[model samples]
Target: MTNHIIVTIGRQFGSGGHEIGNKLAERLDIPLYDRNLVNMAAEQMKISPDAAEEVDETGLSRFLAYYASAPVDYSSYYMTNIEMGQPLSEQLYQVQSEIIKRLAGRSSCVIVGRCADSLLADEPNLINVFITASKEDRVKRIVEKYGLTERKAAERIKKIDRERRYYYELHTGKDWGSIESHDMLLNVSAMGIDGAVDALEALYKAKK
Candidate 1:
């Protein structure tokens, strides 16, 4: 059967979620949307890629994104306090939501983060997965990947996870990383990244 299943993954900071998503996409021969969603949203917003990155996913309140997309010159170039009702982070989220919907409409693919699970919640072919790991394991992964001390890795994980949680909650009105919000929650600390991928592959096929 030709399956068109959309898999959306939410991961902890150092849980190897992106790696799992990338591997899953490769295994299934489907496109993976992770960091590339920022670029795609930038293009959609008619702004430079870096502009989108400025307000990409941190949920920061800034006007750089507004200035980048708005047709305003120096007259209001420094109007960083302009009230556009929605923050730059929210605007980026809206744009990426459109992209996610369009991508899901086109074919089966794997989307990492950006609250894609909630955005595509109505689709029958949608499978939402949240991957997590123990703090110890995650800290080790972060330290190894970034050459950071264990203390630094733990700190970084806390910061990014908090931002992601707030971002997800702000947009979706759902508790981030909760099992009830997703279709499947994978604890890959012991199973490993590839093992998690194997389980997800089976899930996609079984869901079909």
Candidate 2:
């Protein structure tokens, strides 16, 4: 068995998806990628990691992403917002896709967020899993972890999920949270983090 499995996890905010990914990576002795993807993209583009992270999932904050990959007149360009445009977002997106593909080819790894599933769709050995939970469960988890009130937790969940959905839809042209988009759609509230990891491991082994 040549470490060929590529695990992609899309999760609800505060659902412990990253924790599960970490556990899975440790058990499999492979690398786990989440925030690190942004860092890598930043290094590749020679920009600040914070800037890369700002658009980690979203292609572009403005309409520029839609117009990217086309010729632009840089001769009269200045460092203004419109002039800078979506070049950075486009470049970061490309770097992220490349890094995910490179990691998929290199070894078995657990990738959390950034639409790794769609990015590595060409890899025949990839296993895409979506982790989600009920709104109430997610809110409670968020409140417990971040010390936010129930109302605030609910708002945070909605805001984060909205961004994730927008980013996924824009980049992949696929509906986020749809069962058709993932090989496995799991409810983290049902099994918790450790149990979910065990179940996922078993499922992957069965597939192998």
What tens-digit string does per-residue lDDT give for candidate 2 at 65-162?
22234343323112223555655666677888888888788878889988789988877778899998888888888778767789977877777788
Per-model TM against the reference: 0.85, 0.83
Each candidate structure's count of clashing pairs: 0, 0
Q: Candidate 1's C-alpha lDDT?
A: 0.81
Q: TM-score for model 1?
A: 0.85
Q: What lDDT tens digits, residue by residue, belong to model 1 across residues 36-89? A: 998898787776665566566652213323423654232321223246766556
Residue 156 deviation, candidate 2, in Å? 0.9
- Deviation of model 1 at 192, angstroms: 1.1
Question: Quick one: best TM-score, which candidate?
Answer: 1
Clashes of 2: 0
Candidate 1 stretches greater than 4 Å from native:
1-3, 59-84
